[model samples]
Target: MSKANTAQFFESVKAHGFVRRSAVYRWMWTNYDDLSELLKEARPSWIVIARELNGIGLRDARGRDLASDNIRRVWLRVSRDLEKERQAARAQQRPAEPATSAREEPKRFNPSRLPANYRPDVEIKPQPSVPATSGPYQVPASIDVSEVPEFYTRKDGTVVHRTQEQRERIAQQRAGFEKETRHIDRYILTQKAK
Candidate 1:
């Protein structure tokens, strides 16, 4: 509690590499009763071991053990005070009032802000098909190539006889088809905008 003892305690904290100042409060709680003047003069050694090194546990940080105890004490004190106030208020009671103001009218929504073209009736286009090559069946015009069946494989286990160069050419064609469709989609969007 004295200045010299406080300084000595701080020195001990420093020696222990407890650089954080708030941890000194924890140190005080642990060493609650060793109020010796002799502890002041020594260049007090660092805390070698602590039950907690530093950092609040789930149980007791923020002086919560102390704070919770204080809170309970204050809460009891407040409840007692409130009970006294309530009794006093009851003793000095006045009569209740009758209803005074007129009731509020129900609100109506503004109609003009709603869209005139809002329609529950909607047209849904059919989803496009996936392009399949190397099949006897003709591929549909709207087929999505990414979902296309592998061109090299058939149900029969016979691999298609396209060369590596031909395979690369087909891949390039597929890529070009996808690229052209993206441009076509943009054109469709621009026409729709107009």
Candidate 2:
């Protein structure tokens, strides 16, 4: 074909599309933060994260949508990157591991570094039970009376004062609404600390 004809043909091909590996990687890096958040759930199935990545305009150079499989590969790479970063952070915070020795000597542990609720394996001595006061309000003996607030807002849009009836009602409400949790207690304590 003539040079002009060849040029015309190449132009049309360029206009149509040109998918490439470099382009996909470029797009992934451009949208790294968003992809990390979407994939942070760590769920085994990455179909959802891949779909979200595709939806956010990460595509082939030809402007075609990214495949779930392709996005999954990128997701795995990004997950590895995150893990590496996490490991690096932990390494910075912690002392380097000592070389293994023949002896099984105990390592020193800092009490300040322990988690807020972490308890050492030890027998807890039971306290002598205090006799319950003859009244409607039965606050836990563990809670100091001085720390109890005189007034607080309730979820039902009512403000309660430290009256005998209100105290009893508050105790009952607390018993009913306060559910025990495994992980959230630390978060709650953090919020209170702030």
By summed lDDT, the worst window of 10 consecutive residues in model 1 runs over: 45-54
lDDT of 1: 0.53
Best by TM-score: 2
Candidate 1 per-residue lDDT over residues 103-133, each given as its tens digit: 6565676667669976556788899755675
lDDT of each residue in 1-194, candidate 2, tens digit only? 99999999999987544343445565655577775665565654656655665777666556787676876776567567667978999989998667886577888888888999998899999998876754445554565655558645467844444685466888988776665453578789999999
Per-model C-alpha lDDT, please? 0.53, 0.67
Clashing pairs in 2: none
Best by lDDT: 2
In candidate 1, list every pair of residues with a backbone clash. Answer: 129-143
lDDT of 2 at 158: 46
- Candidate 1, residue 138: the lDDT equals 38
Alpha carbon lDDT of residue 182, candidate 2? 33
TM-score of each: 0.17, 0.29
